[model samples]
Target: MNNEVIVTCAVTGAGDTVGRHPAIPVTPQQIAAAAVEAAKAGATVVHCHVRDPASGKPSRDPELYYELVDRIRASGVDMILNLTAGMGGDLEIGPGEEPMRFGPGTDLVGGLTRLIHIEQLLPEICTLDCGTLNFGDGDQIYVSTPNQLRAGAKRIQELGVKAELEVFDTGHLWFAKQMVKEGLLGEMPLFQLCLGIPWGAPADTGTMKAMVDNMPPGAIWAGFGIGRMQMPMVAQAVLLGGNVRVGLEDNLWLDKGVYASNGSLVERAVDLVAKLGANTLTPEQGRKKLGLIKRR
Candidate 1:
């Protein structure tokens, strides 16, 4: 088991969860507060995604991201910021035989466009959803082709940002390794094994282990599962010699009936890590462990 772990809290994801939860941190101030709460509760890193404050829908607006990052930085918290570059790839296909008719949910854009916020904000860490996947049981698909990934990786390298390669399936992991081999990702690129999403890798021991086994040698990696499997996968990831992630973005309920905030979820993860004979690292320690280059 890894003795020192990096616990990352994904504060607010770009999911359709505003109505499901009473408070989902739609505005930038709320999101920044959530990040500070998580940091105070023992989260080493914060993965952020901006939402349209009015509609609570996922947005790729650079202004929203700018305001969100500004709030986080101004809060005086020492949490490592990891902005998501996974937006702008949602393609909701039309119902029935009219596949050519894209639905209103479609928000497709070029790969470079997705990095506008990253280019502007220059956070210490950024995520790259390594491959395309069927987002859910619906017709929506998350598109990140090899060409897009290569270009994004190169740009991220040039900007000197740590790319957290998020792999949803074995194929995605395979391609991520290919990118590393091609040297698009700079030395010490991080990997995040995303599990329990629809039509992707399931949340299970064998699946997590299989993905961990396939990881490139000496590659720093972490994993998380969604819903009820979230905490369980925390233990599994640590036991399998990997790091852990947890937050409302991946799981809503802290317990069977209890609602969860980002802080509470991260506290639970820290407790779990301690009980497992391991400890979660602080932000500075996490940066050193992951070889991260922190920006203001």
Candidate 2:
């Protein structure tokens, strides 16, 4: 395993995790606080998702993103900000009786409209979910087609933001490479191999290896798994010559019956990386590795 590894803490996900953990940060202030805590715990980057202050549901509000970024910067914690531009592409189709009809929980928007936060805040890194997937336990789908992805990537690139090509499976990897080939991404393409998110890729060594092997040449990448596979994938990612990501977004439990705070999850990943004889990268170091430029 390489001695240098970058650790990213996905502070708050756009999932139904608020009900599972009472401490999950719903408000912008709480999310920023959690991110600051994770940075203090040795995370190189904080992957973010803003939630509605009133309903505790996910939101694509630009003001919330601005507020979170402002607070993180004000706290004086040096960490890379990675905002998600993947939220506004959801398509929750109704059951067979009304398959084509818009469902009750649908929140679909155009690709450009989805990136309002990234456009305004101009963070160093923003996620570009490479393709669509049938999200777990629901008839809902996270839709990101080829054309939609192309538009998102083009917009982020135009803004001089590094795109974290988030790939859930091999197909996503293929599309990401296609983006690189089409000049949508920069020379040193960056990728995040997301594993074990329900109906997507399975959380295992073989699956991780396949994703890593299929990565485009000259690409910088990170790999992570959900729940029990979290720490295990940390080791696996190190062995595979990639960075690691950990947080409540992917896993809710610290143990069998324990709910984990974002800070504790990041601390656990730090220890695991150290135990493997690897040194975790700081935010600045990670920026250089991933070809990210921190713009104020």
Q: What would the TM-scores of all predictions be? A: 0.99, 0.98
Candidate 2 structure quality by residue, lDDT tens digits, 1-296: 66899999998899988788878898989999999999999999999999999988999888998898899888888999999999888888888888889786788888888899888899999999999998887788999989988999999999999999999988999999999999998779989999998789988999988888888789889999988999899999999999999998888889889889888999999999999999999999988888888866
| Top candidate (lDDT) | 1
Q: Candidate 2 local accuracy as lDDT?
A: 0.90
Backbone clash count for every predicted candidate, in the order shown = 0, 0
The runs of at least 3 residues in candidate 1 whose Cα sits more than 4 Å from the true structure, single-residue gaps closed, are none
Assess each prediction's global lDDT (C-alpha) against the native. 0.93, 0.90
Give the runs in model 2 whose Cα sits over 4 Å from its true position.
none
lDDT score for candidate 1 against the true structure: 0.93
TM-score, cand. 1: 0.99
Error of 1 at 29 (Å): 0.6
Residue 28 displacement in candidate 2 (angstroms): 0.6
